[model samples]
Each structure stands twice: as C-alpha cells, then as structure tokens.
Target: MLQLFKKYSVVIRFIAVFLGSYFLLSVLYNAYLIYSENQTEFYPDFFTNIVSRQSAAIMEFLGYSIKLEPHETESAVKVFVEGTFLVRVVEGCNSISVIILFVSFILSFFAKKRATFFYILAGIVFIYTINLIRIALLTIGIYEYPQYSAVMHDIVFPLIIYGTVIILWIFWVRVYSNLEKNESQV
Candidate 1:
C-alpha cells in the first residue's frame, strides 16, 4: 500500500488540486450568478449587454442596419437586422460560463503563478473576443443564408468555440503548464 501510494503520488496530487480548484471556482461563480440574478446591478447582464451591443455594432459597421433592444420579460437582448428579427442574446450566449470553464481547465493544469495569471487573462480575452465575432458572424450568416442557419447555429459555430478552447488547452499544456516537462522528468 505504501509503495503504491508513493508511486502514484504525483497523479493523486494533480487530481486533488485540479478537482479542488475547479469545484471551488465553480461554486463561487454559481453563487455569484445567483446573487447577480436577484440584484439590480447584475454584472453578468452587463457582459451580456456588451456582447449584444458589440455584435450589433459590428453588423452595422459592415453595412448592415441592425438594432439591439432589451427584451421586456426574457432577460435577453433582442437583435434585429433590417427590420427582420434575428436571434436573442441570452445569458448562455454571453460566454461567461464558457470563460469560467476555460479558466477552470487552465487552473487544473497548474502552471507557474505569473504565467497562469497572465494566460488566464489572455484566454478570457481571446474567448470573449471570439465569442463576440462568433455571435456577429452567426447572425450575419442567418441573415444572408437563412437556409443554413440551423446547421451553423446547431453545429459549426459551437464547434468553433469548443475547438478554440481545445487549441488553447493544448498550447497551455505544451508550453506554460509544463506538465509534459514534469512527466518526462519522471
């Protein structure tokens, strides 16, 4: 038993740290979400609004007349293009949860302190920016090619986001996390 424990100690430590940090961060985030839902000054909503407004602005910049309005009852920002209603920018579409998950995964890898902090920040920005472009491009795709809306929304767009996270994870593990380095040393 003692020999087995010594042999697998690294694995055990990694699992414990990863699970513990993920759980702690997730719980805190969920609590914040709950609190935000009840308050007038909700931060998540702020991010949602930024996403909505930015997406709409991007569309308009690219010669499409777009309008973004707050939904009265749905707690979402409604998007309209050239008097034609498009999609609703919901909480899920805001990308906070995605960013949270990304951060959690990066934390699980357990990199150097400064590297981890900067990488997390950069990853958040990358994900958020990509999400904005994804929403905008998705809306444009629906407007231009309504026939492919279902395919794009249901499949391709999601793939882009998830694929980006996977790439980011690969980069982290191969570079900053140095898990490979530690493993190779063993």
Candidate 2:
C-alpha cells in the first residue's frame, strides 16, 4: 500500500489535502450554525434565509414578478410569493454547496502550483451563484409548468446545478492544465 501511494504521491496528496480541507471547513461551518440554533425550529429559518435571500436577489435582478419572503413554519423558512410556488429551504440541501466546495478545491489542487486561494474561493462563489440561479429558475418553472414537476425537480434542475459544477471543473482543467495548448504544441 505504501509503495502504491509512493508511486502516485502527487496525485494522492492533492486529493487528500483538497478533500480533507473542504470537508472539514464545510462540516465545521454547518455544525456551528446547527449548534448555535436555540431550538430545532431555527434550522429552516436559518437555512432558508440564506437561500431565499440569494435566490430572490437573482430573481429581482432578472425582473421577475415572483418574490421570496421568509415565512416561519414549524422550524423552517417557507419561501413563497403572492402568486407563486412555495419552497422550504433546509440544511441538508446546502450539502450540495459543500460538494461544490470540495470539487473546486480538488480542481484547484490539480491546477497550477501557483494558483492562489482567492482564485479557488472565487470558483466557490461562482458555483454558489450558479446554484442560486438554479433555485430561482426552478421556483419559476414549478409555477409555470406544473405538469413538469417530476422531470424538473428530479432531473432538469439537478442537472443545472450539478452541471454548472461540472463546467467549472472542466474550465479549471483547461485553463490551469492548459491541456488544449499543450496538445497543440505537441
């Protein structure tokens, strides 16, 4: 086992360090929030506040009629508009954000050694923005095309969120790795 890792030391080191850092950071932040809540009811309020505010800002910028307001339910933020669908923002969903963080870190590790942490941080923000857009579109889509709920929620919307992450990963690979440029030179 040691011999195998020695042969792939660089690759293993990149994966271990990047993933380890991402997981620890994400888990710590989320745990802090969860533990800070005074009661179980506070979880949804906290989670939805972040998601709804982010989503609403994007929707407002797009000039949409829909608006998000936080409605305190049993322990969650029920996001709704006067004439639109409702969505409950919760903690587990934001795990997607964590996954994105991990992926960005891993990609950055494979990027140029001189790559700045700020660049990787920007990638994380880009991913989060993409996710916000996805949620906003999903809310509108749910209202506009009620019959497409299964496909939209299960397939299409997830593709948008996860696909954006994939695109970022590829972008990092190309820009940092310079694969195309290297191939051309070869």
Candidate 3:
C-alpha cells in the first residue's frame, strides 16, 4: 500500500485538488444562479425584455406590422408577435459554458502561474458574451426567417456555439501551451 501510494502520489494529489475544486465551485455557482433567478422570475422577464426590444427594433426597421405580446402558452408564456411568431426565453444550465470553464481550468493548470488566472478569466468573458449574442441572434433569426427557422435554431446555432467552444479549447492548447514551452526553454 505504501509503495503504491508513493508511486502515484503526485498524480493523485493533483487530480484530487483540481476535480474537487471544480466540482465545488460549479455546483455552488449554479445553485446561486438558480436560486436568484427563481426568486425574481428573472428568466421570463429578461427574455421578454430582450426579445421585445430587439424584435421591436427589427420590426420597425423592416416596416412589419408584428406587435409582440406576452402570451401564456401551455408551458411558458411566450412573446407572441403578429399572432404568427412566438418567442420563448428560458434560462437554465449552459453546458457549453461549464465545459469551457473546465477546459480553461485544465489548460491553465499547465500554464504559467501568473498568466493562468488571466487566461481563464478571459475565456469566461469570451464564453459569456458569445452565449448571449448567440441567444439574441437565434431569436432574431427565428423571427425573420420562418422557413429556415428550424434549421437555424436546432442545427446551426448549436453547432456555432459548441464549435466556438471547441475552437477556443484548441487555441488554448496550441497557442497557450506553446507559451509554456517557450518559457521553459528560456
């Protein structure tokens, strides 16, 4: 037992610390967001406000007669515009964001100490901004292109977001990992 522990102690310790910390932080943050959103009914209100604002702007620009109203559907009260289009906003777990967070954590684990936190922070900001823009664009796309709406919302948008996350992960591995290599050589 002692010999086995000694052989893999460092690996075990690193895994324990990293995985344990990540799980704790993720769970706590998710719980807080869920609690806060539930308390304030923030999802519906926020979705309504954003879609309405953007939809109104788009309609005004295009000279469309669509007036969006918050209508209660079977499950969610969606913003129904012109009695034809409906926009629903729901905020929940963003798996891609969580994946990005974990990837950033793992990449920065092997990076320079001083640069690691900054790299991870930048990744967080990037992921958050992209996610919001994705949602907004998806809403707009659904409203405008009713025919291609299914493809855009279901297939294309998901690919874009997930692909962005994968690309960012690769960038960190290729470029940032090279930085660590260069530093070691110096």
Candidate 1 lDDT by residue in tens digits, 1-186: 999999999788767777787788779877866766755553337778788988888888889999877776787888999988888898888888788778877877766788889999999999988998999999999999999999999999999888988999899978853656775798
User: 104-137, model 2: which lDDT tens digit per residue?
Assistant: 4654455444454555676667767777777778
Off by over 4 Å in 2: 39-47, 60-75, 92-96, 107-114, 179-186
Best by lDDT: 1
Best by TM-score: 1
TM-score of each: 0.86, 0.73, 0.64
Candidate 1's C-alpha lDDT? 0.84
- State, as a TM-score between 0 and 1, how close model 2 is to the true structure: 0.73
Q: Compare candidates 2 and 3 on TM-score and give the better one.
A: 2
Which ten residues in a row are the worst by lDDT in model 3?
A: 89-98
Off by over 4 Å in 1: 38-44, 177-186
Which pairs of residues clash in candidate 1, taking residues 3 or more apart in a chain or in different chains? none
- lDDT by residue (1-186, candidate 3, tens digit) is 999999988677757767776777778666765554444343434533454455455555655444544445422335445566556644332333455455535543556766666766777767655665665566667777778888987898778777777777787678766886898899
lDDT of 3 at 181: 85
* Candidate 3: Cα lDDT at 18: 70
